[model samples]
Target chain A: MTNLQETKPLMHLLSATFDSLQSATPEQLEHNPFLQLRKQGLDALARTGLPTPRDEEWKYLNLAPYIRHPYQLPAGKESLSHLPQILPITTIPVVFFNGLFQPHLLSPVHGVTVTSLAQLLDRGSHDGTALGEQEHSIGQLLSPEDDPFVALNAALLHQGALLHITQNPSQPIYLASITQSDQPLFVNLRFAIRLSTGTAATIILDLRTLSKTAPTFHNIVSEIWLETESALTLIFLQNDTAQNYGVLTTRIAQTARSRSRLYTITAGNGMVRNTTSVQLNEPEAETVLYGLSVLRDTEVADHHTAVEHLAPNCQSSELYKSIVADQATNIFNGKIFVHPEAQQTNAYQSNHNILLSDDAQVYTKPQLEIFADDVRCTHGATVGQLPQEAVFYLRTRGLPETVADVLLLHAFAAEVYEQLPLEPLRAWIDQQLSHRLFDIVDLAADRKLVDLQFATS
Target chain B: MHNAKQPLLTIENLHVAVDDKQILKGVDLTIYPGEIHAIMGPNGSGKSTLAAVLAGREDYTILQGRVFFDGKDLLEMSPEERAAAGLFLAFQYPVEIPGVSMLTFLRTALNEIRKSNGEEPIDTRTFLQRVREAAQLLELGNDFLQRAVNVGFSGGEKKRNEILQMAVLRPKLAILDETDSGLDIDALKIVANAVNSLFGTIQSYLIITHYQRLLNYIEPDYVHVMYDGKIVRSGDKTLALELEAKGYDWLRSETLSSIELPSTTT
Candidate 1:
């Protein structure tokens, strides 16, 4: 990190990207407030450079190849046929392909307003709605100084969706970011969600790739603002192929009596990092984070989360489980901070992992900082294989070892998805889990399991 | 309903060890179809070890001996294969498997056994009917089938669940190892009645216990006394009453004097 030789490749890439951005579009610069933010982000990127393994947060993942790869903007035209099959669980869909918003695919909902950040900035006045009202809340919450990738995302941010929810939508909004390209490309995406007072909404952010050719590097950042008495249930689904790398960052700011339930599910291969940070700025706010990673082959899924209790009577709980097979790797780093004024706060964090093979790897760390004397905080982590006694018990009932292993692993992961509000989505996940566990999809087994779950519930 | 000449299970000179410590030493026994044989012994006399070894528990190492089930090499099969071959061992302590409903477990197991027998998987209707009948016979509520396998089940409920599984599976030889250990009088009678109801000429039972309290509810044709890793003496149902009155201490002394005698032929 100290030597100039170590930073040369990243520096070269950064300089090239900065020059390209400076010359790419001179016409859209007059009324764009984000242009200044992008310039500042580029300058910051030039100064700070890229992060190496020496950084504590990036210790488990090596980004040398991802950072040094020569990538360009996607040039190939995409079509509707390229869209991967999404389960028909949500009524509304907001689609983004290769970092560009597709207005034609968006379905209008009654209680929600979806507009691009660029359009709002074109109006050039604070209309007391969307990003114009908050005045660059995107850059404020997703500060470029937070991480080198965040700085890169800000430097390259162009088309971002600004969604404002004013009431309980009848159906969940499926915000899908799909990537498919013939050549190596960089896909940068940003989004902001603002929930009005007393409103409740569920949002699903589905990030997937349809291309299996050149690697697609996705850098996505999302900021959320929850007003008083508002609730948000957000599901972040990462289902990219192995030929992709991504960094997904989500930051949430909650007001008084607001609640947030965030779920991060990784069911596909590739290298991805998901970072979520929630801040309770007012009293009586609560946040719960649930994560499950089912990976195999050469896939790598890394998750880092932070929950900060800045006010009294705020509560936070986090549970993350992983089933890693083959030589795949999984990492979890969670931090809970209870400030001095955050008295009577209750925080809990736990991470559990099951390695399907000896080659599978898992690294988990739970960090808690409680300054308040009256706070209750607990954190723990465990990494193990399938319980042998349970396996033998199942085997005694005439199930083969492979079936026993699959059943136990499925049960281990069921805790995360069982609480899903939508039954169809839960059933879809059950089918997906069966496909991930066995080479051939066992539809009968999946059907039986679906019946069991429904009948028992 | 009895096949006296053709033996269903034969264990000859069986010796089993766990972690190189011999648990079963030169044990010999045989049971015919349509027979109910009980093994009454002291706490550490290798009663459960025999049952576990018969059910293909891999922890135990067989230093010497052979076991035959229906004239096949029982020791050579995996636990699942043994189960498919109609050998079931009601565990001394049934392990709890959370998140797998009893209905799913039973159906999957029955389907696997059926597959091994070159038969199609049981239909849903038949499976549910059999499960309901077995649950009712064991006095287990329908809610029990919806619960995770043995999860949060009491000791008595776990034993009853084991009987329910035996009833649904209908194994040729069902080894109940200390199933009566943690049951009250009422649950004991329910479980015994379930076992008795399932008994037939083709299905045999090997009940292992430390006391003779359960023998009153379910009569056994023959009773064997196991001591210090060997079947020291075996007799009829009257022997259970004799052991209940005189206790295992009297047999210990008598066994000491008869140690050099050749093992029983019958």
Candidate 2:
């Protein structure tokens, strides 16, 4: 948008695709309310094409090589034979295969309503008044112009889900967005979750790819609205294969006395960037954000978050930890803004990282802007290796060097994941993390590095 | 201990250094089975260095020396190997490891030792029972075992926790490095009694301290005085009383004037 010449070619290609896709719409869907929203998204993308490293938000990430590849739109009818092995999946998820929602695969949870966007658009055309009201609410939250990825997702929005909760579900609702493609593909998906007054619900957004051969780029945008006294727990498990890329942008707004907790665990070999923005719309709202990324190989995961305290007496606490090994990278940037009227707001944030190898890297930044004089805000960031003293202490207890390393790494991440409200999910995360750490340890052991260090006289 | 009994630990001409600064200069000591040897020294006299080096701490550089434990070359083994070989050092400052509970640490340690010995893992019930009995010896409750290892513990509590670990590990040779540093009289007696109760024919102890008060509770068979990184005197229990009465300064001047060789040679 600011006269950046490098992003011109892909921008033109995406623009032409959007125009052709719009022209191919069925005659019955021509009067759909999403038509206007799609046009708005296309215009926003035209103004600001694919983000480059020059952009402030994408400073540490370089997507030029990734975006340079010619990616065709998803075929809309990929097979779902690989659904059973998508994850060690205990619960049947609301499946979105190739960005298309499958209603038949969704199990009906208590007091929750799941509506496909395609169905909603079809009904909106018949009853324009109902769709018109929905459009207004969705439009305000999905401000596509805020981010290039959000705009891209909105422009190519093929299918999505809208979840409404009226009571607390007995188990967490699993929304799985999966991509299974042999050819390079581009997928865009959207979701909006609304909780009624005094209602509470937990959602697990698990994103992955069935195939690890061809690269699939998934851009997702989610909008969440918590009413007065409602609580929402959102956990994002991005465990994609090595050939996939993901960008998730979530916007959440909380009303009076509402609570929200977000946990982001990215253990994927592919690259992922998660941007979350929370608006404390009313007083007495509380939010907790926790993230842990155990990355290895050439993978990269970046988390960018912003919390706004617009009302008084709001509290927000954030802690993000990363265990990066090999040549991988993890980046965290957290921003907390307290307005003048938001007095008595208490905000705290901390980011800690452990680099096992010399090439492993972590970049962390904490930005706090407070205009109120009566607010309490504290932020800290630390990047260090494993403490040698602690390692020796563990080793002296009859644990081998590799075993000692694994135990310490597990203990380092346990501080964040121990707060998980769901026991099964917590155990799953613990197992997943243990597998990743053991991989690292086994690799180290294979290199005979442990032997070289502790060689006897 | 009779002369016919084989030695549990033997340190000969042990010269150790840290970052090029020599700490233990030609230290020699030998302990037989069922013997308790107390080494009294002032601060920085290398008493702690001997304990650390024996436990296979890698921070110190072993310039010239050899250590044998149960007839095996101790210097050639890694820390875990040394640990599994029944060598334990009660650290001067017990480390605080957050997020790792005392129960998990001990269980893991015991299992690893058992694993290396080709033994099966103990059942959870038996393990918990053992931990309960060990905790009771230190007057500690089960809640204390559930908390993070040594985290937020007082000085006395940390020292007692070390003894609790010693009780569970049941090492053949235990080296206590300044275990009585920050203990009150009541905590001192409790800790000393726990050590005494754990000791038997198969267990020997090397108690390192700055004061002889701990020896009053857990009596030592031999008392050695360390001065300037070397053992200056070795005698029976009355030697500890003499040193307590005369203080370390007397031993320092006496060693400087007489320049007598360590009694290990005799």
Taking every candidate in turn, the Cα RMSD to the unseen true structure, in Å, is 3.4, 4.3
Per-model lDDT: 0.82, 0.82
**Collision pairs in model 1:** none
At residue A328, give the lDDT of candidate 2.
Answer: 92
Q: How many residue pairs clash (N, CA or C atoms closer than 3 angstroms) in each of the candidate models, in the order given?
A: 0, 0
Error of 1 at A399 (Å): 0.5
Tens digits of per-residue lDDT, candidate 1, A278-316, equal 999999999999999998887889999999999999999
User: How high is the DockQ of candidate 1?
Assistant: 0.55
Candidate 2 chain A lDDT trough over 10 residues, lowest sum: A448-457
The local lDDT score (0 to 100) that residue A171 gets in candidate 2 is 68
Q: Per-residue lDDT for A323-360 in model 2, tens only? A: 99899999999999999999999999999999989999
In model 2, the Cα lDDT at residue B154 comes to 93
Name the top DockQ candidate: 1
Error of 2 at A258 (Å): 1.1
TM-score of chain B of each: 0.96, 0.97
- The 10 consecutive residues of candidate 1 chain A with the worst lDDT sum are A446-455
